[model samples]
Target: MPGVIARILRRTPDTRYAELADMRSGFNSLAAKVQTVLDKDPYGGNIFLFRGKRGDLLKAFYWCDGGLCLFAKRLEKGRFAWPRSDSGVVALTTAQLSLLLEGFDWRQPLDAARPRTAL
Candidate 1:
């Protein structure tokens, strides 16, 4: 579960992502074309971005210093909230992805909606 791929839903345009120099991207040529907007983008050396043609689906590329890896996901019913065109990409943690999957906005300040309580 820790190294599994997680997806962001929404038909995001291929031009939304900018590539970084600190990482190597291994998406196919089609995926590469969609990432042209990110040709020289920077992620502060923590995250990477990838785009797939199937309705704006994206995969998050990341590494733990030991090696590199990719995480992918898709929304069967809705689109993801994209950042402003002028804004940089959003970075997410594994825990954050789990929250987002349950319909929580990971960027906002919120308490757990279903915290367990001792009887």
Candidate 2:
């Protein structure tokens, strides 16, 4: 499971939708966009991530287990942190993706407290 997640995170989507409602689109429509607009295979097993204009909702589209799967997340208290660029792909590590999904700043994650002394 970790290996699969790692592999998927290594391949970031080339495009991102600006509206959350747009992500509400069905599989066919999303697949069409992925095919025509991005010129990428919708069934190629790459994960595409989309964020809403308000940054509170996020959607992930990918091909999985012989079919397509769409996963969505909506934050209740805080908005998701996203890249400033409205276009192009953004590569992320597994940890960064996890942070993004958890509504944290993936670019500069909060530092952990250092050990007071070596054991």
Candidate 3:
């Protein structure tokens, strides 16, 4: 399942966010906002991410399998890391998106320590 998500993200060129969005919005409203506010095609093969004003909630809108898909998450302990810009599209890589979803700082991820020997 994880591999599938990685593959999908790799194939997708546009993983973008609209800075802040209304978390109460449903699929139709988000689709409309994507079309009107961002000047983007709602049905286009791109992942659109939205963060709530409080910063703890996130919503992802995309087209998949002949239907629209919406994925939402709310951090129990911390807020999702976001870009500095207030309004506009912020492109993110698959790794960055994953880190952001896990409530980590995608901008400056700490380097993992190298192992002394390979097993």
Candidate 4:
């Protein structure tokens, strides 16, 4: 998870990323799936929002080093609190991903990210 961040893009760009920035090569099935999804669904929408049927598994795919990598996460408690289609994919940091994987609310602090000034 070095160099690459585990973020859920709240507003992913039109061109989807088959692979994230820092995914390692070899033994990565998720990346290949992501590419397939992108190839089939090129609506310029976020691929992160796409849900695969695996029962409590969330997959993220990427292409790196001339290969594909697939990332999977499973929650012991509940399903991921995915953002709305209108909001787009919500990007999360590694730490945030950890929290989200455990079914915690990762978007709380962001709601109050207002600038502060000393009076």
Candidate 5:
């Protein structure tokens, strides 16, 4: 998770890993299928992530309190760097998920653009 997101979820339980699956499911569909198919409880408070076939869209499923929340993101320029495995599930750390969401390659998220001099 990024700084902002990390802070927001600071007190929340540890959701260190996100499940990456090749799914084009909507809110209601995912909420119903993820638990049984993936064998994961959506109400368990872990983050479940899914990517589109085109590699341009992403959806994150999370359980907050008693309800489920879905977050969707799409890249306008470059496609998101998705895992190259076949149709299956991949577990990613929070850091990797954050980089992926920002359009950066999660495998190599390096950005050293700090200012050398301060005014």
Candidate 6:
């Protein structure tokens, strides 16, 4: 998935944060809304990700293959952990973005395991 992730991250537009929006928002409404808030072209290839009002669903919009693509995911249980900012967008790192997509707490990453030898 690294290749796919690399492709998505390194597109025409840079990855960015989008304010929370309605889950029912479809292509047209979201495209226009996101464009307005971002001040960037929706079709310019930047991937805009938004959390749902209830925080259970996530919506992603971007341009791909000569068309616009909208990706949405809903968690069956826990809500997606989001930053404190709710009024506007907040930037996220690639690792954070990945963890967010995977429904994990990206804010605090776990430390790597360390092997120990005892005499």
Using alpha carbons, what is the TM-score of model 5?
0.68
lDDT of 1 at 17: 40
lDDT of 2 at 59: 77
Please give the RMSD of candidate 3 to the true structure: 3.1
What lDDT tens digits, residue by residue, belong to model 6 across residues 56-111? 89887888889987777787889888887655677666667777777888787789
Backbone clashes (count) for model 5? 0
Candidate 1's displacement at residue 38, Å, is: 5.9
lDDT score, candidate 6, position 110 = 85
For 32-68, candidate 4 gives per-residue lDDT tens digits of: 4444634433232433323334335555544344443
Q: What clash pairs does model 6 have?
A: none
TM-score on alpha carbons, each prediction: 0.41, 0.74, 0.82, 0.42, 0.68, 0.78
Clashing pairs in 5: none
Per-residue accuracy of model 2 over 5-104 as CA lDDT, tens digit each: 4345445543333333485687888788777766778888777777777878887788876988887777888887876545555655556677777777
Report the Cα RMSD per candidate: 8.7, 4.4, 3.1, 8.4, 4.9, 3.5
Candidate 5 per-residue lDDT, tens place, 37-115, comes to 6776777787766777677877777778777777777778898787654545666666676677778887765788999
The true-structure Cα RMSD of candidate 2 reads 4.4
Each model's number of backbone clashes?
8, 1, 0, 17, 0, 0
User: Candidate 2: where are CA atoms >4 Å away?
Assistant: 1-21
Candidate whose lDDT is highest: 3
Pairs of residues clashing in candidate 2: 20-52
Which residue pairs does candidate 1 place in steric collision? Answer: 5-71, 6-72, 7-72, 7-73, 9-80, 12-56, 18-38, 19-38
Candidate with top TM-score is 3
Model 3 lDDT tens row, 32-102: 99998888998887889999999999888888779887878787888888888656887888888878877
User: Which portions of model 5 show Cα errors greater than 4 Å?
Assistant: 1-24, 85-87, 109-119
Model 1 CA lDDT for position 4? 33
Better model by TM-score, 4 or 6? 6
